[model samples]
Target: MISLLFGAGASFGAELHKPVPPLGNYLFDKLVELGGAFAELPDDIKQEFRLHGFEKGMLSIPNDSRVINPLQKEIAKYLSSFKPSNENAYVRLFRSLREYAKHVNVITLNYDLLIEHAMLMSGAQKVSYGIDANEKSYSVLKVHGSANFVPVLAPNIIFEGNVSIGCGAFIETNQIRSLNSHEEIIKWCDSRQNSDLSPIMCMYNKEKRVVINPKYLESKRKDYTGVISNTRTLIIVGVKYIEHDNHIWDVILDSAPELIIVDPYPSEEFLLLLKQRNITHTLIRDSFYKSVLKLSLHIRSRVKIDPQI
Candidate 1:
């Protein structure tokens, strides 16, 4: 069982037109410029940003309707703004995942559906997006709620985290075509989201009150924790190992899977932590595609073609 933990940077190379809005405090300037709820922060929230910085400052502010409502809409819009071309590395990455890893589990902090699209495109026929019946299929645990995941008022449905959504505005994701282009996906997403007509999508918070499948979230955490504990090797791509993710760090450190970190600029704090902990790790100081190219020979020898085709 192998696990690939992804962050926002994981899909950076695959995005179309523009780059994704940065996670943590890097978006403070952008959010400020974008204005509206993000720009005109309340006095207390603004003070937190001034004092601590974006990451910690966000944590300080309450995740109430005032902040979360506006923020979710904006975030969803921002995440869905990009398109991945055929040449996108994610296509190759997911194909590799399908062929190489016997049991693949993805834990991601991104709200985009790039992984899902890639999995679908890579001929991974039965892919599970943390919902419905995904038995024996590739499991994608979206640590953060996805742009496609929408709030619903339906009863008897289990959801990941909890949020007080507008009772009237609820929607669900569908089985989109595997070869759907970025344009098709964007159109599909916009239709599903329904803009201001519907208030769906979940944002990341310790205790989020939004729409997502509880079954999906529960399985992801459990599987990731177990996989990290047992697997000899773990590949962490495009992640910064930030403070909000201290809990994940606890497990990764405790379990201590042989770490392969792929980032253009690796985190010094994380590297220091690895040293102090004496964790044997490899740092690939390159973009995701180059890193994959670096390991292509090893991968080629290990992976077998999918017989499903």
Candidate 2:
């Protein structure tokens, strides 16, 4: 069995509709163009972004600021605007893994719906988003909260203990209110332009806090642990192994699966880490689309050698 992991680079390379999503550093400029809450952002804040970085710049602002809620809403609106092309690497990869759907798991660090969109476009009728693992369907785990994931706050719910007001005035980690369709998600995003509503996304932050519901978070983590620990191969695409993401990397290290990383330029630190760990891995120095073609052929050849694979 094999599982897949994706990062922001995967989305940047994906063939989505015109004006593809930008990486973290370039995100602020894109949001500015969208012209909702971002338009209200102060010039000094923009300057801070230019100097330090997106995450650190965001952290510099107080959590309870007026801009945070609407900022998250605009993020959802902008990301949800893009539609995945019918025949992209994302769709092709899903097609390749369709036969092994039961045994495969997909984990992504992106906030966009590209993976979900690709799965549906690939003729998938049932897709699980890690909370409810379906052996009969593909499991796409969004480690960082997704654009479509909305928080459902009960009146009785109380916020406490290092809760991030950066996400919103209040954080709801209990029940997740998932928008079923793209139209519904768009409507939700557009509904509250100036309202105090926020999506369940953990925005660009160096701290990497997960805003997903506790129940859902636990289930997804379990699924991730189970799949990564026992899978024959782990395919990582366009992901940078940074120190802050040790929660993710540490698990891979402990499991020690056969790693197959697809990145045009693999960082020296990442390569060194792989060598130091003494784990078996293959580095595919290429883009996502070209790498998918190679992977498809490789899967075909492997299946021919061992039919059960």
Q: Mind sharing the TM-score for model 2?
A: 0.85
lDDT of 1 by residue, 1-309 (tens): 446788867777444453654655565666666675677777777777667766556666563443555566555555655555555567667665555535445677677767776666666666665423232356576655566554433445443233444432233333211213444434543452333322343334443434333444444566556656776667788887765555467789988877878898888999998999999888888877566654443344333454341
Over 1-309, each residue of candidate 2 has an lDDT whose tens digit, in order, gives 667789987777766344567887898888887777776677888788878878877776566534566677777777777677766788887777666555556788787887887887776787777733343456688877777888776765432323345452354455776676667777865654314456777657786544444356556666677767777788899888786776678889888888888888888897888899998988898878668877665555544233332
lDDT of 2 at 176: 74
Cα deviation in Å at residue 101, candidate 1?
5.2
Could you tell me how far off, in angstroms, the CA of residue 150 lies in candidate 2 after the best superposition? 0.9
Which residue pairs collide in model 1, if any? 162-209, 163-209, 163-210
Q: Lowest summed lDDT over 10 consecutive residues: which window, candidate 1?
A: 168-177
The count of backbone overlaps in candidate 1 is 3
- Candidates in order, TM-scores: namely 0.70, 0.85
Best model number under TM-score = 2
Clashing pairs in 2: none
